[model samples]
Target: MQLSCPLPKFDFDVITLGHGSGGLLTHRLLQKGVFDILGNEFLGQQHDGASFHMDGKLAFSTDSFVVHPIFFPGGSIGDLAINGTVNDLAMCGAQPQYLSLSFILEEGLKTDEFSQILADIKTAADKAGVKIVTGDTKVVEKGKGDKLFINTSGIGTVHPGAAIHHQHIRPGDRVIISGNIATHGMAIMSVREGLEFETSIISDTVALNHTVYTLVNRFGKGIKFLRDPTRGGVASVLNEVAELTELGVDLVQSRVPVEEQVEAACEMLGLDPLYVANEGIFLAIVSEDIAAPFLQALKEDELGVNAAEIGVVSVNHPRKVIMESRIGGSRVVSYLTGEQLPRIC
Candidate 1:
């Protein structure tokens, strides 16, 4: 339910040390800023922690967001915190149910900016069908901290029969990417580095839980494995899983989806799109017999329109990843050896 208390106006335009002092100012800041916008039954109780129920096998995950330039093309750190955790649970074959938020704010930061972040957090949680049950807030000395940072913890229930993990991946399982790669990394780089492209390449930041639900519910165990290529990009994920399962993966460089602008940007920056990051896209390794129908269902969703079969698991080069070029040659695609873009979600 919505909060009934009238929001108290802050006397100061920006936050101060008093706001983090655990005094009347602290209560007022949460009441008028955070709780005022995100009030719900569990949060309205105002206890030290929140209580909720769970059934079936449960999945839990937590992550922190320190994305520089808090605001990006398609989303901000606020929504990123919520969606990132939610996607983590989805990749584990679970249905996200609840989330807890914690904020670290810098002294002298604008109160209005924090309020906007809270508003975006609410929008993202609602869209993902999850609740913000509890949270904490703290303030740091001005120069010691960035404008803002967030930490989110999530819990979800695993669907029955949806047994998915990297261990299940084996020879013959087909690899499919939900959409274009490297969009998010490039999107952040363009704005941060002041490189302009003909088209505005926004970050592909979105929730993937719903689409994951559709696949898990329909395919069940046939969906052997699922993963959202985040910080390490698709290449990193493939390399790690290959080493884990001790099976080689052969990817077609041409089959991997890369946007025209993103490819060009990568070329100019002397970067490989395979090593970039993505927030909204995912990879699925499914049984070959089920890959066709699964791809059809995935493409039905807006995010998977450009989805394609990129590769397959092989036993020849165990514990390695090989990429077949569009020119009919093969080469090794190594793990991400270093960071390409820092503070990119």
Candidate 2:
């Protein structure tokens, strides 16, 4: 017999302790709401754990989102959760396939808001061409947990011909930034501090897996390294790469793409855009032979329209990052010692 139970109206529009009780209310939530919205073959199996097949190397990554202000100028936590996890896999030269999500929801969260977040998650997953194969939700006491926190684990298969790892980096490799930097950090700061700019600074929170996939499909192993500069922005990524490869990266201030307003904000706030965070930006270390064609390919995409060859790997200062200022001054670029932006995904 087919199950025909209709969704029942809850007296409270907000979540409560019963939502996590794993009883009638929990079943009602899964059957009536979540299942209908996110059902797929793997999820429909309804097993305690999901099972899937893989042929070659498997790439797995997981990240938790605890950004302040669940909703931001350009994106919500939901989109960040999905895109961030997907980007992690993409950095490994993998094609993201399946995801598992776990929600830590506060007791007082409104059902409507929860539904909106679910909608956002669905949209992001669809755009990335990945499926949410499994998930779990738990409601915490009102004040104990923030409005919501999300943990997403992703699984993908690395492209056969792709050898994207830091070990592959070498001296003379060219460095490229996918697009402009510092937009995401400035966007968050603008909203939190109520600072208005001549133009709105929206977060650069987009999925980069497809673009990476296309690039790898074209260049394969020629792309030496891939990284998404998230927490510590461009400076940290360069420093880490330099240390790992024992090479120096020389960046030109004029070659890097920074939005005009972002530069102004950084100057006004005494913050260096290089140390700021980015959500939708990535850096590639490409061998000299393929750098020209790879750079052109990156510019062809809307997300990478402003792509620029910002720097090149050098042996002058081993394991360091140096920048050439627009005025022709060279200086060491240190990683910001303290937290520039806290709780940023």
Candidate 3:
């Protein structure tokens, strides 16, 4: 006898506003779409900000977020914009201090929504210990803009005895990740059209100055380079570092932390988590001798409890990133060829 099987049914076929409602729809979008494309340590944990310590110097960084729908689970454009910039500075081993905000507002956007966004900005700044000292606001004629757009620039002071740069990477150095991967991208994708999930996935958007400070305080000059995998996730970051230093980065696939739901979503959607965007996580390359202590210190922090040494620098395969799969095979991890998800910030 032959048995009949039922096919899976989907509730929607395309994107919808409900996807951006910071609920179930949002989680599905991220898990199936964004996380599948870009997954890395900083993007996975779904935390508020990365916290660490630094010596004392000057560091600067900038970022822009154009997430559609503007608002979603756990945060909005206001806080995302601020945290994005602050985290960039922290990736340089700096403590964020000030920021500049610029907005492109749609003419028909509700004043109430704008006010709420402003409140979110203030709240995020207060939590990160940074100030929005200057900003500009512009309104575009209706239909010319997406309800709202944000761009932020941030500046911070680097710890005095700290030195972090891409050139500092050396063979035998260990690669340390702050936490899990694919949370922010999954959070944003969960709100995209058609795709939907049962659980709510929130954006892991937060500053990392404090967390960075902690690492720098404990590790000092043993730390080499720091970068928050945002646009291209860990693959892009590792590739860039490899190209910059003419070194290879060998990563252990099983050692890289990824949430089960996120992994399932990515597999279903044919996405590579290593290429996803992350908002609240970072990577640190430290001397092999200090890698153990650094890993231990990271585990003690709330934001980095899942931290791991996923890889190490290699002298072979210059300017390449190679991943050792769980099945014992190796593959080259290249830079993202195109925009996996535009406006992912």
Tell me each candidate's TM-score: 0.95, 0.94, 0.82
In the range 62-136, model 3's lDDT, one tens digit per residue, is 776788758876678877888888888887777888776767767666644655566677667778998665554
User: What is the C-alpha lDDT profile of model 1 across 1-345, one tens digit per residue?
Assistant: 122233334556898888888888888888776777788999889899999777779999999999987888787888789999999999999999999999888999887667667777888888899999998889999998999999999999999979898888879999999999999988888878566555578889889999999899999999988888989899999998899999999999999999999999999989999989899999999999999999999999988998999999999899899999999999999999879889999
List the lowest-lDDT window of 10 residues for candidate 3.
Answer: 1-10
Tens-place lDDT per residue, model 2, 72-160, is 77888888999999999999999999999999889999876666677778778998999999988898999999899999999999999
Candidate 2: C-alpha lDDT: 0.87
**Backbone clashes under 3 angstroms, per model:** 0, 0, 39
Ranking by TM-score: 1, 2, 3
Clashing pairs in 1: none
| Superposed Cα deviation of residue 141, candidate 1 (Å) | 0.6
Which scores better on TM-score, 1 or 3?
Answer: 1
Candidate lDDT (C-alpha), each: 0.88, 0.87, 0.77
Off by over 4 Å in 1: 1-11, 193-199
List of clashing residue pairs for candidate 2: none
lDDT of 3: 0.77
Error of 2 at 344 (Å): 1.6
RMSD of candidate 1 to true structure, Å: 3.0
